[model samples]
Target: MTVQFTPDRLAHRDDPEVSKITAISLSGTNTERVMHIVVDLLDELGPQTPAELEHVYRSRAAVNDWPVVAFYSVHKRVSQMKKHIGIVAGTGVREGGAERVQLTTDPLKAHGKITAHMQGGDE
Candidate 1:
């Protein structure tokens, strides 16, 4: 579905000095963890370009001492989340030529979505 949103909305939220999430408290690889982070970010802050997702995610990940570098780049992870998990869908309108994405209200359970994302072979 297409959506038109103000780029101004991207700056609507400020980064917190310390992330509410305690990295020492969570389990999973950096890839798994950041996936959770991006999903929650979109779910909370709404549709955002991949660049916007990186800005907030890296900042928050830093505060938690969670290494942001991983097997998949942040941009790729965002695309994977949508292409594989189905938790977030593209808004269909680029925020000034860059792709923008938002969360999907998939009735499928989280585990179900994840299972699909983890499947072998190309989709």
Candidate 2:
């Protein structure tokens, strides 16, 4: 379960999806943490709407006793993840329906990225 990190062990190296995720250099304080949380949640839940993402974020924030994770924050992160990471894709919806975003890679591939990240490797 404990995957050791090395030059070759980076999630992006072996997986194309992860490669896209890691290709972009994240800037600003705490961006990395936000990206990690978004990736982890997507890996677990597959595709989701912005509202669903907000719900997940709120639940996590509550569990950690952290400040509320605002809906805007979740939306921003999701958008960034789609633009920079490339592992997530969005589907447009009708006027009343919410747009949905999901991982571009298959479940097994996502599992690889998730496992690598969970084990302290980079994605």
Compared with the true structure, the alpha-carbon lDDT of candidate 1 equals 0.57
Superpose all Cα atoms of candidate 2 onto the true structure and report the RMSD in Å to 1 decimal.
Answer: 9.3
Candidate 1 collision pairs: none
lDDT (Cα, 0-100) at 27 in candidate 2: 29
lDDT of each: 0.57, 0.57
> Number of clashes in every candidate structure?
0, 0
Highest TM-score model number: 1
* Candidate 1 C-alpha lDDT tens digits along 1-123: 222222221111332312113322223354455666676777678889988888877777767776555322566567657765667788887876787888776323533454344443232
Q: What is the Å distance of residue 39 in model 2 from its true position?
A: 1.2
Model 2 lDDT tens row, 6-36 = 3233223444554434433332223435556
* Model 2 misplaced regions, further than 4 Å: 1-27, 65-70, 91-96, 106-123
After TM-score superposition, what is the CA distance of residue 109 in candidate 2 from its true location, in Å?
Answer: 8.1
Q: Ten consecutive residues with minimal summed lDDT in candidate 1?
A: 3-12
